[model samples]
Target: MLVEVGASARLFGGLEQLRQRIEVEATAMGVECIAWAPTGTAALALVRAGVPDGFASPLPCILDKLPLETITAVASHQGTLQRLGCRTLGDVRKLPRGGLSRRFDKELLTRLDQAYGLRPEVYEWVQLPETFSARLEFQFRVEHAPALMFGARRLLLQMSSWLAARHMGVTSFTLRWWHDVMRAKTAGTGGELTVGTAEPTQSVDHLSRLLNEHLAKVELQAPAGDIELIAARTIPIQQESKSLLPDTIRQGEATWLVLERVQARIGKAEVVRPLLAEDHRPEWMQRWPGAEEPRPRSAPDPCQLPVPDWIFEEPLRLAERDHRPIYQGPLVMLLGPDRVEGGWWHRVGEGADAQQTNVQRDYWVAQSQHAGRLWIYQQRLANDETGWFLHGRYA
Candidate 1:
């Protein structure tokens, strides 16, 4: 926790911003105390003395005011030191170095020198675990699912910090809870569900939102006494740095992420997005897939003309008279007969849901005096039932 930020404070938006960011992350990880000083020992003493910011004053000037008992090495010899009229670290410093060295262990002098930045301090780095799993015991058994968010939030904060420390992103995680001992056996221990994201993320807010949505739909089988969260899988993500320029425009997230969130709130099947198809025919050119489904890549528009504003579910058969299509009245051809001939190799739906699969037609940009401009097509099939139909309309 003793970080050297002096070299990179400006890179992180100056000292004030750097401090705020550190404090926010530390608080999220449940750190109770924090302090800043030039030396590690000085910072440690300041934190133990409840001084949140040790940088506001000169190093020795502040460390001198702290009680002798703040440092463990000094505290062990506190009674002896106090009897010798030493009440503070400054008082200890005034004692004869020869007499103090003889009276106390070497640790006392070492700690004193380290506190004043006269000696160097070495840090013991912590090794992070390979996987993350945490458990929280509820003081009162939770009967309602929504009541579990408070505990769930804490676990998520810890997980986020772990993910950041390890430089990884979580793709999926499982939330499982244990029921009270009084619950019936048939109801089981408790219910559990796995929450998955479309992409790897270490965003606690996004995870919390998904968890809240899923929890609302869950009917607790029994009173829950405790809950646990296990990260199923993780992937290393490239952390992008924010641009320092003020005029840089921020980019938005992919559309698929929005679709996935909506799918989480509602049912997956209930959410469908239009994806491009390989066919040339307008109706067969798009497919409705579930929101969670990955959208297949498509080629860019080849034609220069703009497409119609709307296409009917099924081509609306139009009444023909005088060898021309009629919607409300006689139609006037605004644009030419653009030939569309494809889909012979494909078969559409079956039964009542069947559709026109083979499209052999001459399309036109037509207008009716009463109905406005329309996209109509003349069936080129030789069958007697072949006629003109309205395919779409332009706004």
Candidate 2:
């Protein structure tokens, strides 16, 4: 961006004076952008990384030899400025603008144009919202804790009135007081406090109660002379319900309040509900402090597929009685005998390749007479080799 200063640098008390002004304003308003002051009318901006500061000087040919970095560095010292392979503005000037466009970003061109004063640039300071903010202009500072506290209280009263007008309550805010060495005895900084919630609050009395609870812990770093109290943040009061609630629901409100208090004290993460995970991975399913509604379940109609009541978290070892596998377990509901077979096309050793991962899965729904609901299955090879395992269970 190019910023055009109509008058010469000398008009603003010279370059140093203007720079200081910029720094002060920027610091106060948190402006960290780069800027430059050049002597020119309807300045010309060209982005060349290695160009010297005097690219715009009496030497017109210097423009051809100047590197864009020289112009950019004088404006903003971005870390990437040093990484470009070009050595100087002269080197950048030697490169074709077409290739330069492909290699470097548009910012380089913009800064170059801005440095020569060819482009238009403007900056506006941020504006604060209209709210309860009281500023004190002190001719002579009053630097005493009690005096500052008194001023703060007056400002707080103003804030309270503003809140009352809006029917709102402040939950958080910061106070800033300018310091002058001439008036105040002590040089002190103000402090901040976190105000607790007010039960369905709109009254100044309730807010004061919350503030007082925190005021006891607030301390001053210096003697406050001039004070400004600002309503930094606020919360709206809950709207009144048109219908009345029974005693049981009111009790539920109390319980909710208790839970909120606990969460506030211990942190929100400590209280949770279990939620079902969408992924097929077993460990990924289920969350603590779970969902409000229970999951739905239904039995497969026609009973064609055997369903199980419980599936082992992991498949267990069984003692074989003969060549045929002997099933001995406190089983639950049994499910499928669905057969899956097809990894023959998979490439061996390519773990994720579908052709390699292709294998047959025989699903079953089985219920142990003693155990609850379970879904177990046996992995069956195309050649009929089988291994018993558990997969899922109904809750």
Candidate 3:
């Protein structure tokens, strides 16, 4: 493609930076050969002539440098031009324009004019679509999920171009594969696999790696006939601001991408974060399989009461000696008797003879000579029975 970057050089910072950016983008899209020139026609001619950065000077020698195919559009005039001793485009331009226009169509002179920067070059700009969906059909049926990687890579390259053109990033996408008609009875119509990113990304390598991890675990039911990739979700992405020091945003994005790959390889449910709950019972204070961001809970004034560092799943029953709970030796209470009650809702609709479901406890932070620091609670029962239990311990 012949792109006119002269007008956009300043927009992209400068000519060198613009060239570098274009080359980077083309590489990302898997484009191999790329050439640059001062004019659109010269760029195409240079690429066709196997030249790199073939900038056409305003001299007549540039005409000899270009291939004959560069002027193939005017093949009918080649003989007449040769008879006139015109060996190059500069030679043709040296001829009288009025006679040249009369001998050939106006397009010939127009092309020559545009190539030498005499006329303005204009072209329609391509726009990206709002959604992306691409499909590929293989000549042979794919028997395994991993075999679809080649076709998937092509679709990913197209997606990379689309994302770059739109200046957006994809967060989630789906890949669906269809089975051969002959194997439809065993494999059904097809199967679908969905992958999501922790953060929006336009990196083709990152997406491809994540897909590879997911496909490695997928077992195909039957031979696949075709594969399709669809972008299920996307988000706007801004160009990151340049910095002198290390970029924390990029570092965080890298970490998220690693986590995403690990999750794809294993299972999403296996990765989790802790969420704080509104409850007084230490065991029920936090919930697993939670949001990415941990929810913070308000802390009570330390001077008012001391909270245990650890809480056991099931409190251990303790023996008492001389009205004091014993664990290897008599326990010395260091902190308060903080009262915690209520569980009556569990027995609200039952009869009065029903067993009490409520709990009333006075918690205390105690220190035992042999047990070190311990969290003990005294449970009060309706039948006038009371018991002491070791609920937690501190290092």
Best by lDDT: 1
- How high is each candidate's TM-score? 0.76, 0.33, 0.80
Q: Which regions of candidate 1 are displaced past 4 Å?
A: 1-8, 55-69, 75-105, 134-142, 162-168, 176-193, 223-231, 239-245, 249-260, 291-307, 319-356, 367-369, 380-385
TM-score-based ranking, best first? 3, 1, 2
Which residue runs of candidate 2 sit more than 4 Å off their true CA positions?
A: 1-164, 169-231, 235-238, 241-249, 252-256, 288-333, 337-364, 377-387, 390-395
Pairs of colliding residues, candidate 1: none
Q: Supply the TM-score for candidate 2.
A: 0.33
Candidate 1 residue 129 Cα shift, in angstroms, is 4.1
| Most accurate candidate by TM-score | 3
How big is the positional error of residue 53 in model 3, measured in Å on the Cα after superposition? 2.5
Q: Among all windows of ten consecutive residues in candidate 1, which has the lowest summed lDDT?
A: 298-307
> Which regions of candidate 3 deviate over 4 angstroms?
7-14, 56-60, 75-96, 135-144, 150-154, 157-161, 164-167, 177-191, 221-227, 242-255, 291-304, 344-358
What does candidate 3's lDDT look like per residue over 307-388, in tens digits?
6778788989999887778999899999979887776654534576666456788988898998799988999855888999
| Residue-by-residue lDDT tens digits, candidate 1, 1-395 | 66767888987899899999989977875679999888878888889999877778788889889998788899999999889998999999998989888878999999899989888877786677999999999899899888888788889988998898899999999998999999998889887879998888898988988888889899898999999999998999889876667755659866766766787888888888788777667777788987667756766454323468998889998988877789999999988677778777776678888765677888889988988889988896466557899988999
Cα lDDT computed for each candidate against the true fold: 0.85, 0.50, 0.78
